[model samples]
Target: MVGKKSGKALRDEGLERTDNNMDLSSWPQVQAINQKNYYTDYLKRDDQYLAFRLQNEEARTKMTKTAKDRDRALAMAKPEGAEGEAEADGDATMEDAEDTPIETAGSKVIVIHVGSQNLRIGLSSDALPKTVPMVIARKASKNESEDHPEPKPKRVKRDDGTAEEPENLFGEEWSSQFNRMSADLKVHMRQNKRRMLPNSKEMVVNFNRRTVPETISEHNDPMRVEWTELSKPPPEYIVGQPALRLPDSSNPRYKLYWPILNGCCNETDYKSKRELFLDISLILEDAIKTQLGLTSKKNWPQYSCVFVIPDLYEKSYVNQVLEMLMREFAFARVCFIQESLAATFGAGFTSACVVDIGAQKTSICCVEEGMCVENSRVNLKMGGRDVTETFIQMMLHDHFPYTDINLWRRYDFLLAEELKKNLCTMDEASVSPQVFDFHLRVAGQDTQKHTFKAFDEVHLAPMGFFEPTIFDNSDKLLGRRKLIERSVDIYDGQSNDPVSTAQSEILTALAPPLPKANGDSQPASSEVQATPARPQQPSALGRLQDQDQTPRSSVAGSPVPETNGTPQAGGANTPAAAPTTQPSHPAVESRDDILPVFPLDNAILTSIAHAARSDEKKMKDFIGGYYGRWRGHLDQWFLDERLRSLRPAFTKDIMIGVPPRDLDPQVVVWKGASIFGKLNATNDSWIGQLEYDRLGHRLMAYKCMWAY
Candidate 1:
């Protein structure tokens, strides 16, 4: 009976046996806390409500039923063996696969590009990738999550002692409710930034924002309050965008972060590292459903996932995290591709150097014949954000007499980024400094005139990529042109010095002719007899090896017999007799012919590197394509004279390939990733789940070596 006793009864009996034991339930404050809220009853008397509570409940039931019906209709519309349709406006379907017959195998292809700032998702054959800010904001209230809260997994033990297939704990009712809530909240948040409230008489003029109130007074009108806030219990986490915390919230535990920073997951903080791992998996799952049209939870495991990351990040722990996610999500197959390499292939190039300039950093790599040259890749910690920050610092330095650090902190960096996109120009001459005047509102102060001279100074910020020191970086900081030069220098040697160590090494490796055959008797002429006869054997140095075997004619300008056995005579039609024995000089191939092959033959800069690509063109003095877009003061300080010197004879030019006119620069990587998925499907390049489980990270690491 004791063993069967309830836990509460056993605890109470133990407490009674102890003389000094105190019963917390007997405490007056504890009792009061447990009592019903009488104030809420008083408040409810004045609160607006339906004539009957039953009617209100019935209305909610009807709405719930309607949402279920809609979801069912949507599900019914999607038939088995039918390919998911790409969004008509946001994304374009790529050249239809020659054999797109829907896979009867039940597996689907989903390509996802997770960048430092945004996430792009689309089906394998989609021409364009749908982009979403890699953001997932969570509200603190459990109630808010009821509608679209993430599905909870339940573990079930099997007879074999291993965990069986996990079950989704939420029922259809919750799923439908969550879906409706997600739709409503999305609409609310999107419309929250509008200049005018929907169906409202008031216009939200400059600096005036419609605000939501916590509660309505009994005497005041409830509908008069414009609801701008989209979250309840405030948002506990905001991803992608800047972090915010409401000071008035009771529990303002907020977290905003990027799962990836500098192109990889943060390894320093274990908690954040794990959180990011889970977050990316969840985000990718959503992409599979929303973008690939695989809504059935069971079918999720049948989707192949491809993650695009920087080439330099292969050695990082990202591979490990990806493997973990692969198993956790039960994906049909998975693979990783380098962002720049994907872009190169997507641009339809067998080889081209790639320069990827993103929001947080820039990477330059040489690709040759479908392989990335590991030694030639360079990653720099400078990109679009730094330019915007430079603009912000410039404004703060000039405008606010007594700079409030908070003011600077509160300023919208996104707005500054947009301004940079619009007003920033590549040509220094176009920078016309204009006096800008605008009304500024501080958190606690009245609106005031915030006036400052906005000059072509904006153009100077982009020059940081060219001259890192302007942004307080060391001389080691490499600009776009310098990046290209670095790649070329690997083969051509430094321009300032004629003989590069690489060139010398190559020269040393070329074998000299075998010791001349000993001419018995008299010591072989004291004068070293030049071996006019080239080596019979070919060399590693290609045809550079000398193969001529003819004695020099002592006559000063005598024409030598042509190798074709044609006797040359000085005639008007005859070219000067080919000087076969003129000079046995070592072969010096032009830089173009000897350029080391890389994964990409040309340096193709995606949209983010528009500034760098533009600056590089100006440096090289190229005046075609997008070069006409440059309209700025010519700043010599930002120029790389070395690039100008090398331009005339430089064999290879950094190529910023012209993308399809409708494609956005930002989506280039995703488009490439999408195309890659299609190629993988056709080529059977992806590692299937069974093989992945068997080979594991070793296979992943091995593939990373040449996955591009």
Candidate 2:
């Protein structure tokens, strides 16, 4: 970072700090990503293997098991505390006090933990576990909505009953509800309006980026027609005022654009852990209506389920992805497991840790004796995508030295998934383990030498909450300086601007003084300045003389060929620029003088205005940590309390599965999510609106680790 400009310096001319997110098309497609061949290509060939969602057959059986066990446990449990303790003191028969249930509802049960990826259903009778993916068809829309846009007529019971809705008949699966909703009084939120207010700050935060930007205008071309002059208005309105031209402004489907879970229209606007939960649940409930008819409240099914996800687990994508899932199951409930203790009971892993590796980030947490530890948790920016990007860069540098988008196209998402399932782990044995080689070719020509097997198992990969670094056998292993320097020399625009020149200097300037492979102490850099045309090149070379071992790789490549196809670098005859290599990634740092980013809900209106005027770098700085931390904190809190009460009931270890609608309430379920925006654990989670045994027990858990 020596010669590299800090984010502030990069803010003016539009160079992003981190190039994580470049161009992601949001244009509505004829098909959803789920319906596309691209996404399905990665699914393992064992597609026949069952996905363990709450509705799976095995999950139904668990509900029966849990109900039985709960009946037994309560029967065997001691009665009132002191009195029973005293009675058991002498008469051994006192142990038979039997903490029996107040009455017998005679109902079986199951706990459904709705996860972003999978839905788990637990049976109480046997505590058998079954899970099915939360996945439904993205293309499976309301096949009947348009034809029948009305809520199914409600049924009334005459058995001395008050008017009631489907709440009494809640056990309906999501698929069947969609059809029913279409046939009934249909509900839709498409009529609402949303707009982000403006600000005078003249800077904006870009929400769609994966990494913090070095400059605000890096990716976005904000339409800004600064008023240079004003023209008089027509006749009556022309009273001494001048007419001004403004860029067209509109916010269509703004509600659809904000985060599905956290984006509230107002402070008290449908926000609460419950509302978020209800959103997915309601969507799912509607999905089920589409496939089945409804009955009177008294004749309704017995359970409800909603998808739960840790806020930061899938990076900040949890909400966006959940929305996509909701597109599949309308009544789906996407809950942040870390924000609700009930979620921990849903994921199923108690007395252990859950570590989730998602697309853009990683998160970990622990549950002890079925209770999650609120204070202990970990979240990192590096996730499967980050790792894959590193791989892609490696392939570009070592394998394909060309710049053809097609060669490396159509795989950003697929490759990221591969990293999640195929890479990442802890291996303490071999000298180098997690690293492996990759092949990359844009147009043609060797770009870089691939090296890396897994995350950090080979060469040390960066690891930290914010900052990270790795080893480099090549020159200057800090920023992507060397490669950037080469790019400057090769490009036609040359090194005119401050950024290009500054980058070149950052790369070649700090030449670590060291002997060549032959071990010869190099000459002084001041004496190395040789070219007048590339004025600063030789002077920058002086910095390399001090390194123990200077690097060799440049930023992702050596120039390829001319349009006519010819090699662009050092040949057998030409002794060119000294081989300069550097670290694979650009060094990202947090600075004290850094621009401030406010809490999202605190100043929404002003932030929106600033975002419109400012560039991408400033925008990311404003939103980066705030959005990430909000979700992280939420996941932590939700899990802690949910697991507290489930501890005693986990008397015996067992794998729980899904149960039927009539039997779902008798079992426990677990859900996992990230720790941001998470509330602290508490003891009042026994009354969760989840399916539980007659004993009134509901268990929850999240995906994470204790790091022990």
Candidate 3:
């Protein structure tokens, strides 16, 4: 407001003046001036502000220069050796990077492997996951507490001293007698007619001989356990190991349930989808709280999770699980990996035919590199539990010592499972009848020793996989349960057209009349002719009208009039109407449409054939080995024999490689999940809460690593 001063006068007074009055909020020079004034004032009045400003200045001076700055310095004739020394320092830093702990999200990562029988959970840094039986025992209501009367125990058969002892068939004397009998039988068969011409070329078979130990160790008895009856009242809920150990006597107080069955959600067992989801949530929450020591909900936001899903998975199942982890558990972020891919990672194989036989389901898929081959996935709705039930049936038929055995009971179920593991063998050496003794220990009862002999029962029990018909004879529903149907992806929209019902009905009713078969054509009615004709174009329903066809009336919901085979007065220029038909849509094939069960050998061959259709190299690589969670009774040779017997032509060039004996197949999937969890690139693939909130299910299409 004062009188304007000259430039030299303003310089002398250290003051500046301007005539322009427009807003300078966006002006860089004005901003610099204001910032400098604020900084100076704060430096004088605030000690913290002064210290912060000094620290920022020091950091700015030490920061590395940009390319432009380096080029300018070189133009000024600075030393060239400085750039080389800087690069040398960077190289040295990279070389020593191994000693530095990788700064990654893995430290806060929790890997969860949810299986039908067990739930494996642990941090990414853990050497092994904490395994818990995927079972829950809910407290029963008063109405559910009615108990059934227990059956009386069967009387044990006494070994009478009057019977004569049979000759030992496994001793040396019996072997000599068998050889003599075989020689006489061979002579009689030599005179039989030749079935076919002999091969022109001699076929040679190579066998890898394994040395047997000179001193065999005694088989340890697995039947020494004593089952103690629970005397206390059941809690609100039981999970994991304790749930499995609940005695049969306490069955009236609790109801046992397995939330997952046959590699899919056990929705059929629950009242609604909500209840099934609730149980699954409770199981995971309990496992995380007790096993991972994460008791506080507030701390959950600090951790991320990686869920392992099936190779042939349902989109809805995966979506529901992700929602549960994110919205219910409040995890920071979540990611998913396929089981077959994870198995390949854990086994350190670039490509392999993964035959993952779990407690309730067996999944076959060929994984190359890190991706699973499409169409090669086959999920069989049968596994170890089927074998267990089959074994129990076989034993019962042979008058098993425990005649009152009920597999539904906890004790008897455990007993049968243990007996199958102990007595079953695929080796030809143990094909003869063998005597096995098991000590039956019931809660609140005396221990009793029971002796039984098994001949082909042990062998036939495990053969249920190859001969699935044996499972049909048992009470268990084999391959009856269907997988959850996959929901339509949000990105694909709906399968049906978006036309309104009323609009479609009106359009159908107003459809033009069909013309006669002769060359002559009838003219349209006066009402149709009176309406203003618009340019012909495709309708909203995506149907196109031909120019030669009769023009349709624009009036909505109009009814067709009776022509009585008479032509209109002004008729001759109209063209004949073409025949119109409804568009046909192809039926969409779902998971339920496919067969749910495949024999062991057939599944392998089908999987290889599927791979061969895509890439022959992948098929050859997959046929090289069969990697899976095999039991002690089912060896590689057994699978090989089944393949040869089922399809001799297919097995002609196939050689199945055996995995290392010491490699535990049980934890292979879990280990692979852990490996995926530790990957630095996983950070970018995780779906965070903010992203999910904005996109919802649509986020899966963009963020999911696999084919969503």
What clash count goes with each model?
Answer: 28, 196, 0
What lDDT would each prediction earn against the true structure? 0.42, 0.28, 0.60
For each candidate in turn, the TM-score is: 0.48, 0.27, 0.61
Residue 590 CA error for candidate 2 (Å)?
Answer: 18
Worst 10-residue lDDT window for candidate 2 reads 250-259
Cα error of candidate 3 at position 397, Å: 1.3
Model 2 TM-score (2 dp): 0.27
For TM-score, the strongest prediction is: 3
- Pick by lDDT: 1 or 2, better one: 1
lDDT by residue for model 1 (508-528), tens: 221122223683322222121
Candidate 2, overall lDDT?
0.28
Give the top-scoring candidate (lDDT).
3
